[model samples]
Structure formats: C-alpha cells, structure tokens
Target: MHGALPATLILLAAAVLAVVACRQLKLPALLGYLIVGIVIGPNALALLPNSEDTSYLAEFGIVFLMFSIGLEFSLPKLKALRHSVFGLGAGQVLATIALTLPLAWFGHLPWAASVALGGALAMSSTAIVSTLLNERVELNTPHGQQIIGVLLFQDLAVVPLLILIPALANPAGGVIEALGWATFKAIIVLTILLYYGQKLMRPWFHMVAKQRSKELFIINLLLVTLGIAYLTSLAGLSLALGAFLAGMLISETEYRYQVEDDIRPFQDVLLGLFFVTVGMRLNFATLEQQWPLLLLFLVLLIPLKALLIFGLSRLMRSPSSVAWRTALSLAQAGEFGFVLIALAHGHQLLPPNLEQALLGAILLSMLVAPFLMQKRDALVRRFVASEWLNESLNLTQIAVQSMLARNHVILCGYGRSGQNLARLLEREEIHFFALDLDPERVREAAAAGDSVVFGDAGKREVLMAAGLSRAQAVVVTFSDTHMALRILSHVQALKPGLPVIVRTFDETDVDKLKEAGAVEVVAEVMEGSLMLASHVLMLLGTPLNRVLQHIRSVREERYDLFRGFFRGATDDSDDPSEQDQPRLHSVLITEEAASVGKSLGELRVAELVEIKAIKRRNIKGVEPSDEVVVNVGDVLVLLGRPARLAKAEARLLEG
Candidate 1:
C-alpha cells in the first residue's frame, strides 16, 4: 500500500509539472503526458512497475477517442466533401502504404510484417491533429476541412486493418480463409447494429431523457458503449471499432450532444493515460545508443509522408498553400502505430529490437508534429505564392457575376428559406445575389434567372465574389451555428454598419448571433411558440388585441421571459442599441487613436450624454470608469441624442 501511494504521487506530480512546462512553452499538453509516462516508466525512473494496468487504461483511451471521433461522422458532411474524402483520402492511404512497404521490405522485414508496418506508419494522429486544429481555430478553413476528410477515411480504415492484422499473425493457418470469416462476421454484426440497434437506441435514449436523471443517462451511455464493444470483441473485431459504431449510431439521434458533453472529461483523462503508456514503452537506452539512426528515420519518414499527402492534394486540384499546410499538418506517425506495434509484438510478428526502433522513430515524428503545424502558415506562404495566384483564376465566374450587381442583397445558403426570401425580394423588384454549396440547387436557381453562385459563404473570397462591398444587406439562412457565426464575423468585419439578418432553428443562438453583429435573428422555435401562445390566449376568452399586445411585449423585451426561464443572468449585457428613441452606440478605441491614453473624464463625453459601462477586451466590464485611463481595446458605451451620439462616436473613432 505504501509503495502504491508513492507510485500514485509520482504519476500525478510528474504529469502536473510536465503539463505546466509544456503550457508555458506553448506546446500541446499531450507531449507533457507522454513525458510524464517516460519519467515514471520502467525504462527510466521505474516509478511504475506494472505495464499491464497501463495497457488496459490505454485500450479504453483508444475506445473513448474513437467514440468522440465518430460523433463528427455525419453522412451529409461526408457527401459534401466526397471528392476530398474519397479521392485524396483514399489516395493518401494507398500511396503511403505503397511507399512504406518497399522500404520496410528493404529493411529485411517479412512481407506480412512490412504491409502491417506500412499501414501503421501511414496514419497520422487524429487525436493530435484535431486537438491542435481546433485550438488554433482553423478547423473550418479549406485545408482544415481537407485534413479532417482524410482523417475520417483513415479512422474508418482502422476497422478493416484490425481484422487484417490478426489474419497476418495466423498466415500459416490459411490467412485468406481467416480474413474471409472475420470480414463476414463484421458485416453481420454491422448489419444487425444498423438495422435493429439504431431503432432500439433511439427509444432507450428517449426513455433515459424522460427520466430526467443525469446519473441514469451517464450509466446508460457507459452500458451502451461497453456493451457494443464487448459484442464486437466476441465477433473478433477491436473494441474501439464497436465504440466508434456506437457513437455513429448515437450521432443520428438528438441525444448525441449531451452524450458528448458527458463523455469528454472521461475521454480526455484516459487519452492522457494512453499517451503516458506510450511514453512508458519508449526505451531511451536504445535511443541514446542509436541517436543518428533515430534522426535519419525522422528526416526520411516525415518528408516522405508529407510529400505523398501533398502530391495527393495537388492531384485533387487543391491550392499549393492549402495542400502544403495539410501535408505538413499530417506528417507525423500516429498513436495507432504504437497500438499496432504492440499487437504485432504480442502475436510474435516483430522482433524486440525492431519494435523498439520503430517506437523510437514514431516518437521522434510526434515530437516534431507541433513544430510542423505551428509553422504551417509561414511555410506555405514562403513556398507556394505562385500556386496561390493560379488558384485565384477559378474565381473568375464569381468576379464577373459580382461586377454585374451593385447595391444588391447577398443571401447565404440558398436552401428553402433563402429561396422563399428571394421570391419576396423578386416580387419587390429588389436585386439580390445568392451563394450556396449545392451544385444542383445553384444550377436550378440559375435556370430560373436567379442570381446564384456555387461557393462557400464562410470563405472571405466567396463573400467578396458575391459583391459584399456593394450589398445593401446580408442574410444568413443556415442552421449551422459555427458557420453562421463565422459568416457573421466576416460580414461585420467588412461592413460594420451593414444590417445582417440571420435565421436559426431555435432561441439558443439568438443572443450569440446578435453579439456577432446580426441586426435581426429570426428564431423559428421562438416564433412558433409565440404563435401557439397567441392562439391559446384567444381561444381561452382573451381579447385579440390583448393577445397581440402580450406577444408584442415579449418581442420588445427581446424574449427576456424565455431567456430568464432557460439561460439566466449569464447572458446579461447592457447594449445601448436596444434602448428606445435615439439608439446607444459602443466604439472601440484603437492604438492610433489620439485619445488612447486619455481618461473618460478627459474625453468629456459626459457633457453631451450619459457614459454607460466600459468593457475591456480580456477583462471584466466596469461601470462608467470616468477616471480610468482608456486603453486601445477598451469599449466605450455611450447613450445620447442621435446628433450628439454621432459626434461622440466620431471622437472615439478618430482618437
């Protein structure tokens, strides 16, 4: 018990210290976890003596990680990026395998072992790439989307690879027959899960939801995840595969977000444990003895993988910069390489020395991952400036169309909602341009002489191509919250005073959209509820005028009653624009402003009108900081008559 206490202390202490060090250095915490494992591992300080326990935790880590990955696996998203997913993704995997196999064979590995090694090394770490991309706020970028598409295919390929590995291990007993049986079993299990499992899961989730017990929901989630994994194990497939399938099944239901929110804390901790286990398995003695060999492998392997992925991206007609960034981002050997090597070693497929060497090589690649990704922007611009220009040629259609329209409304997402809006605008003799991703929708709309272009609205170039500068207003008609938020940012940045109307399915995003610069957010859920309440009031002997007044009151308060019932005071903020009569205005002080270092009292805006609260970026808001010196990023909230407020706003802006 005393020994166990010390081991626990060592593990916790090392992890904390390493994580702090990495955070201070602006590196991912994953590297810190790996370092912690190495320090406590048997090959180093030997604080942890039992590798078996770590291995068990590591397996569960992979399961939860895959489950999280599966949540993002929507059919619509796949269909939207079919070209990249199928063409570039498939090409990257097969090409890397083909490239790596010959090298492995040249190193005197058996044919079966060579193929397994190639496949293992070909995969980049989804856990690492995704975490970094999200943190850097690049997940929605074109290259970022391509990287995810390729990673999705890589994750799906793991199921077949899991089966293939076992067959490779038993080649003497008719590998083809073993693989066939395993494949057949996999198909049957998947079919059962798809056909019946989805139906059962929806009701199970509904039942859990009805109970309204958070504990029961969590317990049920664990049971479903583990049960599916156990079933897959019995059918001779990996537990991670089953867990991923379970996530996919849950994703089709409404309860997936709740499930994800609940599982995240567990997944993160276990994933750290898994990386620690990988670190523990690293033999530093071998690395120290063959430092040059490790360096050689890193230099050769990372570039090879990057070149292969880059070539594939180029083949798919991606811009050189985007292709280069994607290539560099995924140039590392993945976590699965460790799992595959461990499994191969267990099956007596790899010699101890070879396993250690491969481990050293993989760890080296992972160590360089942060550097490669961090410098991705600089690297792309430095090398691919010429290709960037060539890619701009494809925007010719957008340019020509945009030049034809001036003072036209730019409508994003030309779906049903957008089409309806267009019809009304057409009847009013209003000129408008629409941008949509669906080729069929764009074509159909164009045939009817509607001004529509095939492009992503979130892209700045696309928005510019839609003549954003010449637009009277912009309307976003999509239910995608992130994309809508991004589009709102672009619109606000380009034209701060432009009236933007955004449509959403529910009231959950009303405030966020408003803050993001949407002049009006039309939430269908809130509107429907209002209509229902009006009808009920009229039927219950209430006056029609009174019912209408109540609804009007609710809108005047910005649906405050609903917000108070659901969201609470956390959403509260004093916006001067919401005031009656002359609207309130907030102006941000910039660095070059003449009043950058001046206090509110010095600005003397108080004489003209009331100075409301001042909010500093990355700091708490203060109530009328009269004596407080104004910083570059400080937001000054002012309310006055329109004429006086306009002068005050100009003073702040000029300053």
Candidate 2:
C-alpha cells in the first residue's frame, strides 16, 4: 500500500504538469503525457521503479480504449463501411507484412524472427491516431475513416500474431498445426459470443437503467467491461478483444450512447497512463549506444510503411489527397509493437541488441507522429496541390460543359434515391445536374444522356460546377449523414434562403438537419411506418378518405405520434415558410411582460394561439408543455394568421 501510494502520486503529478504544458503550448495533450512518462521513467529520473506494477495497471488503458471504439462501431455502421473496414483494412495489413518481410530477412534475422518482426511493424498507433483525429475533429473525414478501419484490423490481427509468435520459437508440433488449433479456439470463443452475448447484455442493462442511479450505472459499466475482458483473456485472446466484444454487445442496447458518454472520462485517463507506460519502456541508454543505427532504421521504416499504405489506399479507389493524408497519418510504428517485440524476446526469437534497436526506432517514430499530423493538411496542400488541382479542374470542366443548366435542380448524389428524384423531375420537364463519387455510375448516366458528373458533392468547386449559385433548389439524397450535413452547410452559406431538402434514414438526424436550414427532411423509417399504419387502418374497414385525413393529421403534428420511438424530439413547425401558416412569429419574452413569471397554462395561450415551441439557453428543448413557466428572454414560437399573431405578440409584450 505504501509503495502503491507514491507511484500513484507521482503519476498524477506528472500527468497534471504534462497536460498543462501541452495545453499552454497549444499541442495535443498526448505528447505531454508521453514526455512525462519518458522523463520520470526508470531509465531517467526513476521516480517510480516498479515497472511491473505500472505495466499491469496501464494495460487497462488499451482495454477501455478498444471498448469505446467498439461502442462507436455498431453492426449497422460496420456494414455501411465494410469497404474500408474489411477491404482496405485487410489489404493494408497484408501488404505491410509482405513489404517488411524482405527487409527483416536482409537484416540477418532468422526466418521465424523475420515473420514476427513483419507483423510487429505492420501495426499503427490506434491510441495516438484516434486521439489526434478526435482532437482535430477529423475522425469523420474520408482519410480518417480509412485510418480507423486499418487500425481496427491491426488490433484484431494482434490476437493471432501474439499466439503464433511463441509457437514459431519451438515448433515441436508443426507450425501450421499449432496455428490451426489457435484459430479454432478463437473461432469457438467468437461463435459463443455471437450467438448469445447481446441477448444477455440487453436485459442486464435494462434492469440497471431502470434503477436510474448514476453510481450504479458506472459500477455496472466497469463490471461488464472488465469481466468480459477477463473472459477473453481466459480464452487465450488479448484482453482488448473481450472488451471490444462487451462494447459490441452493449451497442445493440438502447443505453449504448449513454454508456459511452459515462465511460469516456475513464477511457481517456486510463489511455493516458497506457501511453505513459509505453514511454517508460524506452531506455535512453540503449538508444544512445545505437543512435546512428536506430536513426537510419527509423528513417527507412517510416517512409516505406507510408508508401505501402498509400499504394494500398489508391488500390481501394481513395482520392489522391485522401490517400496521402491517410498514409502520412499512419507512418509510425504502433504501441502494439512493444508488446510483440517483448513476446518475441521472451521466446528467444530476437537478440537483445536487435530488440533495443527496434524499441528505439518505434519510440522515436511515435514521438514524431504528433508533429506530422499537425502539419498534415499543409503538407497535403503543398505536395499534392498540382495533381489535386488537375483532377478538380477536369471534373469541374466536365460538370459545367455537359450538365450545367440555368435554374436547374442541383442533385448532390446519384445513388438509388437520387436517380428516382431525377426521373420525377424529368417527368415534369425540369432540368437537373447531379454530383456523385461513383465514376462508373457517372459514365453510365452521361452515356444515357442524363446530366451527371463524377465528384464529391461536399467540395466547393464541385458544387459551383454543378451551378449551385444559379440552381433553383438543392436536394441531398445520400445517406452519408456527415457528407449530407457538409453539403447542407456549404449551400446554406452560399444561399441562405435556398430551399434545401435532405433525405435521411431515420429520426436520428431529422432535428439536426432541420436546424441546419433544411426546408424539409424526409425520414424513410417514419414515412414507411406511416404507410404501414395507413394500410392497417384501411384493412380494418376505415373509409379511404378518413384514413388519409388521420395520416395527414398525424404528420401535421410533426410526427409527435412517433415520439415514443425517439424521445426528446422538438417541434419542427417553428420555421414559417415550411409550414402552411399565414404567419409564424418568434416573440421574445420581455422582463416587463405580465406573463414573465407566470406558468404557461395561466397565459390562456390555447385561446389566443398555439404555443409551438420554446428555446432556452444551453438546453435541448422541444415544444413547451403547459406546465412550463414563462421566463424573460425565452423565445416563443407563436403560430396563427398574421392578425391573430399580431394580437398574440402584443399580449406577450404586455405580459
């Protein structure tokens, strides 16, 4: 207990100072944490000598980090990004290994050691990459998604490689036979999880959430995360694997988002410790003795790994800028390399000098990563400017020359929904131009005499080329919510009063889209549910006109009928032009108003007009219920004809 106390205090002090220094410098806090680890580590000041104890506790950092990542990636989301997660991710890992194997062999390492080193070098730092991307608010960008996909695969690949490395040292059994047995064990564990894990998780969380206790919720989160991690460790996989599976199970439950928010503070703190532990393992003495050799190796390794990633990304059809960013962002050796190299040394697969050299290279590379990422955008613009400009110009020329039209509808995608929308517009003799990323689709559409261009709709040049400045309306029909939101922001900034229509898959994004100046957001799930309800009512012998009227009433209520599915949904009728209102007035409650301190029910608002919604500072509000109290500075939405609204506004002022 005495020993533990000082270790904890030292870590806390170091972490605090590091965070402050990094903050003051306007650098990422991760670099500060790592520098603290290196400065006070056993090799330096030796403030904490118990490396074993710190290492054990620090391992939880990766576990919780992997769990949070799994929470963000639900099954549906993974399916949506399968092209990156599986295709590009798998290709990058294999390609890295293939490229590194020859170099490892030429260094005079044995064949088994070469394979082990190749696997070790194939990984990129998820902890650093994820933190940097989150800090930069670029995790949703195309290259950011690519990095995430490859990092996920690298994490998964560690489990098998960890087992295989030790097996290669003493091949009493055939190497293939040992690998097959390990693979079978892993499959069994995963199969068991796939079949029954989510079922058990949902009910467990439901009961916990019923209690509505924050303490209990946090306790349950730790129990489930650590417990699952222990189980996977028992099955011979990495602890991170179990935590990831636990997160995936919880992801299927309604409480996933809440759990994520609750666990993030813990994950961030623990991950800081993990990086510190990693830095502590780097011995400055070994690095000093081998500085020249290590420096040469580091120089060679970074560029080669980056080149491999770039080539593989291009093969996956990523744009040149995106591919370059992804490559540079992941050009360093990963945290997992330390674990692999340690395992390799334990199995006698690597010599002491070689191990030291590899460690020095990896630590230096990680130290350099933050700076590279900070300059990533500038580097891309500087190096890839010519090629990117040529591509942009070619696409813009094609779009304007072949498809541009005055007062035409500008479509932001040419997917299934986009094509359908274009056909309807064509039937009405309305001209349209489309921007899509799928080159094959663009070629086919152009050959069919339809106006379509190959380009990302989120680009300013692409929008301008599609005649966004002159277009009568802009409609975004893609389901990529980030891209759709980007296009919406761009168009709104260019033309604030333009009628922007957005199509989304569900209510998850309806309010956000509407707030971003979308004139209307068509939610597929809500519309489908409405259609099904109408059919059921008709089958029950309700008159067609009555059924249609009921549907219209439900929709007119802003789908309040479906609020049970999506809680805390606000009234969207605040926009005047979107509604069939003669006038929609936004009246601010004044301090002198008689109603300022009164309950909404006392205002006799029902007799005057409807209280559509209310906005307050720092709160997500919907339509005000009758029990709400009127406050000064509250913005109230009063909906009625022009004259009635005028009287209501006067009364509000008087109140």
Candidate 3:
C-alpha cells in the first residue's frame, strides 16, 4: 500500500506460492520459503526492493529459533547426554577447528580469518538434520540420537566462537584477556538468569499471560526473547545465544510446554524466513562461475566432516551404523553456521566473499541432505551386505556370542516383556538377545549397548541375528500360537538340533511346536493354573512346603504328559508312560518358584536337578550361585538329568 508495499505484497505472495508448490513436490516448506526469498531477492527477480529489512527480519528468526532451543534445554536432559553433548561435542569443535584451520590458511586467508573460517565450516546444521529426521520418524533411531547429541555440542560452540570473532577485531588486548572478560560476563549473565530469572521470569509470564490474550503473550515471548538477546549483547555474547539460555531456564518450569506450544507458530514463521534469507544469499553468478570448486568442496566437505564425526561417534562407542548416520546427518553446515558467519562479518572478522561462497555450499548441502538421509538405510544395506559394513557390524553378533552363546537364553520377542527380560538378564548374569520385529527397537537397544535388536525370532533372518544356531535355550514370550508355530518352524529349519522353548496361550499349537522340534511348548494358561492352584492351596491352610510340593507335581505331570503325548502325536513316541516318564529337568524351582517353600537340601534334590539361575520378580539380577535356601516366588533355574528333573518337576504337581 506504501512505497515498498506492492513489492512487499508480491514477496509475501511468492512466499505463499512457494510453500504450496513445495508441498506439492513433497519438499520441506522451508525450502519453498527460501525459493520465494531467492526469487524476490535483489540479485534475482528483484520483486522485493527491501533486501536489507528482509535480512534483519531473518536475523530475528534465528533469535527466536535459538530461544526455542534454550527453552527445550533442561539440565537433566543435558546431563543424560553429557558424555556425548559435552565430551563428544567439545571434541568435535576442537577437532574440526584443528582440521580446518590449516585448510583455510592454505586458501590464502589471514590467520585470524582462517580461524574464523575453520570454526564456521566445522559446524553442521542441527535444524535441517532434525527436521528431516523428525519427518522420517527416525529421530528415535541410534544415529538420530547421536546426531542430536553432536548437534547440541555444535550449537554450544556457536556462542564462544561468536564472541571470539568479535574479540579478534579488538587489537588493544591479547586474546586471553578478551576471553577472560567474555567468560566472566557470560557467567554473570548465566548465573543471573538462572538465579533471578527463575524467580521473576515465570511470575512475569503468568502476569502477562493472565490477560488471556494471544497478542499479550506474543509480546511477552518477544520481550523475553529479545530482552535476553539485548542483555546478552551488552554482556559481550551473541543475543541469540543469550536468548537461548533464557529460554532454557524458562523451559524447566511448569509453563514451559505451554510457552513452547504458544510461541511455536512464531518460531516456525521466523525460522522459515531465516532460511529463505539464507537461500537469497546464494549468489547464482558465483555458483555459475565456481560451480566446479563448489561441487568439489561439497563432495570433499561432506565426506571429510562425516569421517571426522563418525570417528568421534565411534570414540564415544556409539554403535557403528549409528555413528555413520550421525556423521551423514551432520556432514553439512547447519543454521548456526549462518549465525556465526553473520556475527563474524558484523565484527569484520570474515570477508563478504567467503561468506557468499560458504553460504552457497551450505545451502546446496542442506537441500541435498534430506534425500541423503532418506536413502541412508538403502546405502547401509548395500554396504552391510558387502565387506564394508561387515567390519563394523554392531554388537548384535558380539552380544550373541558373549552372554547369549551358551544355554543362556533367546528372547523371542522384543516387546515390553523382552525388554524387562534383558534388564533382568543383566543382573542375573544371564546372556540373552531380544528378538523383535521393530527396527527402531533394535536400533535403540543397540545404541544403549543392550545388543538386543532387529530380529523377528519368527524369521530365519531374525534367528540368525539372535544366533539361534548357537543359543542354548530360547524363550518365546509372544503368545500367538499361529505366529509361534511359524517362528518355531523357521527356527527348527535353521537349527533342528537346538532346544527351542516356545511360548503359547493356546494348547492347539503344542503338538505342532513339538513336531516342529521345540523342546518344550509353554502354555500361558497351564502355568497360570498351576500358580493359582499353589496359591490357593497355601491360602487354604496347606503348609507352604505342601503347597510347593503340590505345584511342583502339577508342572511335572503337565510337562510329562505334554512331552510324552506331544512326541507321540508327532509320531516320535519314545516315552509311553506319560506318568512314569522322567520329569523334564529343564524346569528348575527357584527360591520364589512354587517350590521356593522347599529347600534343595531339604528336598535332597541337589542330586535330583541342576539349577540354571534364580530370578526374583522384585530384582533383575541372578546370584550366579543363588543361595540354596528357597524364597517366596523365586524362579528356580533347574536342570535335572531327566527322570529326577521330571520327578522334581512332578513334586510341584503333587496335590
């Protein structure tokens, strides 16, 4: 409507059009926003006459974005990832600086400029990587975790680097003096914000928010954001970084989720504008002139950075695939790179030409990153099938061999039960691998070093992962009889000689499982009945020992009948006297087992059975040497040669 009104309206129109078009193309809305900025940029269609104002607005967007990051930051969350966030993060910063400083100097920049360039180039874009990963729902993946950790560390570097650039221009004092002063001021500001902001900021927000008006809250959010930004600037740190710190402080409060949700719209709009402004900074003339150099740099930059970050991830002992994904996710420069470069230029620490060149590289890299991430799994598969990823196979195999190798246990399902089982296994010193259908579960478990993942015990491919070929014992927690049969069939195919303990909720699958080579088919209903029977007996005034004996008899009788008839039904009737048949010794009574009311020495059953391990529902660990005494409900890991084991098991069944 005014001087720049028509042009401004046109740019807004282009921004909307770009968003709609990008949605159609299935690209990020931010990419479309950038397209709008580039199309209307001074160097291009020139639809927008006010380029400088656009840049300022874009700068505000970064402030808002950083503030959002701060609000989300919690001391506990950071503490949880401290090893990666601080240790790995700091290492990446130093290593990147060390690696790139020489390269920048070789490019003919002055030492100070070289240092600035090195710092700027070493940083990768967290915003871009996060957006893509979230879109793919892979943020929960191992690589995703590592990527988030490293990016946080990279963001942590931005504040100091920004301060350093401006301080580098001040020749009156040495670097150490400037550094000390900067550090002191930052500490003061941080301490003041945490100590004072917590008391005042929340109340201030409540007072402002009570107006129950959106505009009031928006104004408050802005004030909190820019107010901190302004304060941080006066304290010799970047306003964006300061705002981030303030947001983090407020994030810990009850109002944080509301604050984040409330300000999210503004953050998105501003952040989008910021990316567009960045895109507008891409000078096509230079890209055309130096496309070759830019391409070479892009190729070299991504691989080199990826290699460094990957090595850092491995140094953190992050799983191998996770390390690669993190490296790839962060191989390109991030939004903070823009912030740092802008600060450097503002301080005259970096020249305009370098900014333009690096900006072009970064923008191009960002545009390609999502595609790369989407294709990551495909790439990993190819490499993993080859010798390339072979050398870096995650602990899946190692875990299988270590704790899982012997008669340990094979968890047939990686659901809630399986997860708990593994935790219990750790304490009991029982080696086990969790088998499941979910890839993310496997990845997450692997990252936690549980080495339990990525297999459906139902599938041969999955069994191979669980090392079913070597596993001494197996536990199928999944209760679906049909699925159990399918899994049992597959497992038996792989290891016909291996003992398989199949879990089922129905009796229909018992004969099928035995025929398929399962050593035992455990029906949930049968176990429950015996447990209920024993509990009822003890509750009915039967002595605990008599109750224990009764339950033991029941399990032995049921198993003997099942094992006998199961084999007979399968045409392998070796034992016809189902009652006289030797007890299945594989079933041992723990201190808590129904037999727990009895003692090994009291039962004189040390000669009767072997103890596998003891599991207490209350505790996750095993005693390796569980005490001879019985406890209430203690799961006895028992092994008897056969007849004694079955008889010992029969003791549980006695009425």
Among the numbered candidates, top lDDT falls to: 1
Instruction: Estimate the TM-score for candidate 2.
Output: 0.59
Q: Which of the two, 1 or 3, has more lDDT?
A: 1
Error of 1 at 171 (Å): 7.4
Model 3 spans > 4 angstroms off: 172-176, 209-214, 381-655
* Candidate 1: 10-residue stretch with minimal lDDT: 562-571
lDDT of each: 0.79, 0.76, 0.68
True-vs-predicted CA distance for residue 231, candidate 2, Å: 2.6
Model 1: per-residue Cα lDDT over 17-69, one tens digit each: 99999887767787788888888899998989745766887789888987887
Q: Model 2, residue 483: displacement in angstroms? A: 16
Stretches of candidate 1 off by over 4 Å are 9-29, 66-87, 130-146, 170-221, 231-238, 241-266, 312-326, 367-386, 390-580, 585-604, 612-624, 628-637, 646-655
**Candidate 3 C-alpha error for residue 472, in Å:** 31
**All candidates: TM-score:** 0.67, 0.59, 0.60
Summarize candidate 2's per-residue lDDT along 293-320 as a digit string, tens digits.
Answer: 7887799778988888888888988888
- Per candidate, the number of residue pairs that clash is 2, 2, 40
